[model samples]
Target chain A: MAKAVAPRGFARERVLEAALALFAEHGVNGTSLQMIADRLGVSKAAVYYQFHSKEEIVLAVIQPVFDDMARLVRIAEAMSTPEAQQEVAVNGMVDFTVRHRRVTAVFHGDPAIDTLVNSRADLSDIIERLTVMLLGTDPDVTTRIVISVLASGMYGSATDPKLSDIDDGDLHQVLLDCCQRLMRTRGAIGDLRTRGAIGI
Target chain B: MAKAVAPRGFARERVLEAALALFAEHGVNGTSLQMIADRLGVSKAAVYYQFHSKEEIVLAVIQPVFDDMARLVRIAEAMSTPEAQQEVAVNGMVDFTVRHRRVTAVFHGDPAIDTLVNSRADLSDIIERLTVMLLGTDPDVTTRIVISVLASGMYGSATDPKLSDIDDGDLHQVLLDCCQRLMRTRGAIGDLRTRGAIGI
Candidate 1:
């Protein structure tokens, strides 16, 4: 199970909150430790005392969300049946994603993060865990592709300007519907991966 | 139609290319015209001569992709029937999106660009044209949501690492299948705004 490297504290939480706001306001590439310290009314030394570097701070900020996802995956893996497990897990993942849209937005919006994660085997391992959960047991390439597509679709739909006015309830329904359709279509295309996985 | 602002020259194209690479490397907020000039072995003044500001350079980089999408939209609109037009448009849009995945990656990856587009009504107009083309005349809210979801799904999937090794032809087929599924689901949902216009 994924856990925080540092214990939760008022200072760390404050810094993370500031980082999220600043990162969202000015892309992650745009925000700096000095800026984050300034936003928090703290000195750079104080910020450094809590987190060693900007990258560490970013990881700290994103780690909670990632852990939340990992926890969900663990739950899904613990399920008795793939269908029940997938539906619950997929919905949980969607809920987690929607609840943390800013995280999703910031994560996908910064290319630097992509490079960083791709370069680190540890980070890739974390992602692979989720991918494995997303694919269930022994999924083929095509099944993996469909799952990836559905997840991205859900994330994109949440951030889409065209659906900006959609309420959370309606947005959730739309996501559920789209995911179900995607899964069904995958099965129809000689896809055996999600054989009995019902609604997402 | 959205065309290139002017003819391309090596200097200008080189600047734009450098700017994109840097912007993609560092977030748009992190990248500067000076950095781009330095990377290109050109003076900042030379860079300014080609593009006055970083924002202008970023827009120029994305313009070609937008133009291609707009052209495809126009082609789809020119079709005789709505079904035929949607099929053509969907296929064309998917093609353009997949073909220019790198460029599309920029728009989705950089929050600064997303902010710029949202804040600048004029810039948003370009995306508005694509949305209109996708939805057709008087499309409802749900339709827009589905379209956005499907488009995002296709985009995210194409850029996904798991599918990175898959050939383009296979990816295209995957995308086409996803689009067809979207159409089928949208049809099942029926019209949220109107009673008729049901079924695919």
Candidate 2:
């Protein structure tokens, strides 16, 4: 509805909105600049004026996710204990995923991240940090899978079509429940890992 | 290794192998019949002789997964208890994923699944069954996410390049531990659902 009524100056924001909608539905690989232009009822050149490539648009689309991650990490850092940090990590993920269920479906659904520049390393880092924060240590294979399940569990299923009938409130509770259950805080999943970069 | 010397009569088998490789690397949407034929060093007509469309080829590629799911379900049904049934489901999944980590990555990674013949319903059914089997009941969102995390945790992470260095043996153990911990086995998650078809 907002896209239908936005005036001329909002083309960049409009492009992002259309691209996100297309990305959510058709997937990043399946979506095209032409599709975004069509969604905006504008010329491909006009869309091009704001962004040169699909890769650029995708980065802009997911930039907020990066911001959100940074914010979550910062908040998590403030927590005094590993268990508290784990709570922040789990709840933070649940809240973010729940809020943007469809948007996340694009990235987590197909890992279209690989198609982006070299963001795979960035994503691997985020999952790694969350894994460390969630468990508070260097993971054995078991805890590593915990992160996989914990991360994709909320991200993947939030957008699962079969569960689409499920509403947001219910979905939030479900992810919170699962992440909390799966988190097993152990020996030092804290400052030793993410903080201070090369800590002692 | 297998495709190199299978002989001319194995065009059908070779085509499947090449197509799977292309799908894994390029994704189902990105992969083309020409690409598959090129990989086989054959004409598109020859590839068409084996399978008329990419969709058909995809179905054939994942048919084994369907067969495995059926076999696992049958084996689970024979088990005397839900706990036993859940054990079969979890271990069966871990073993299959560890063995075909890359191949499963093709499907589980991008869910090129959506492109395959409405296997969305079929895939949803499989996830639902596994979720129910693991937890043994009609789930609240919490348990549903458990299956998502559990399934994707193993399927999504098995081929995660970051953890790609880990061997099959360790991957198997990791998945087993994660799934075992997550399966809570509550209420009557048993014959009332999957078996007897229309059971009371």
Candidate 2: C-alpha RMSD to true structure equals 8.5
Candidate 1's residue-wise lDDT over A28-105, tens digit each? 878999999999898999999888998998888777677887788778778888777767677887787777766776
Q: Which stretches of candidate 1 lie over 4 Å from their true place?
A: A1-14, A40-57, A80-88, A111-124, A136-138, A161-164, A188-200, B1-67, B79-87, B101-126, B136-141, B187-200
Winning candidate number (DockQ) = 1
Q: Give me the displacement of residue B50 in model 2, in angstroms.
A: 6.5
Largest lDDT belongs to which candidate? Answer: 1
* Candidate number achieving the greatest TM-score relative to the actual structure: 2
Give DockQ for candidates 1 onward, in order.
0.43, 0.30
Residue-level lDDT tens digits of model 2 in A11-118 = 778898899889877878789999999998889999898899998898887777766876787789789997799789889988888787766777775556654634
lDDT of 2 by residue, B54-73 (tens): 98888888878777776777
Candidate no. 1 TM-score: 0.68
| Candidate lDDT (C-alpha), each | 0.75, 0.72
Docking class of 2: acceptable
Docking class of 1: acceptable
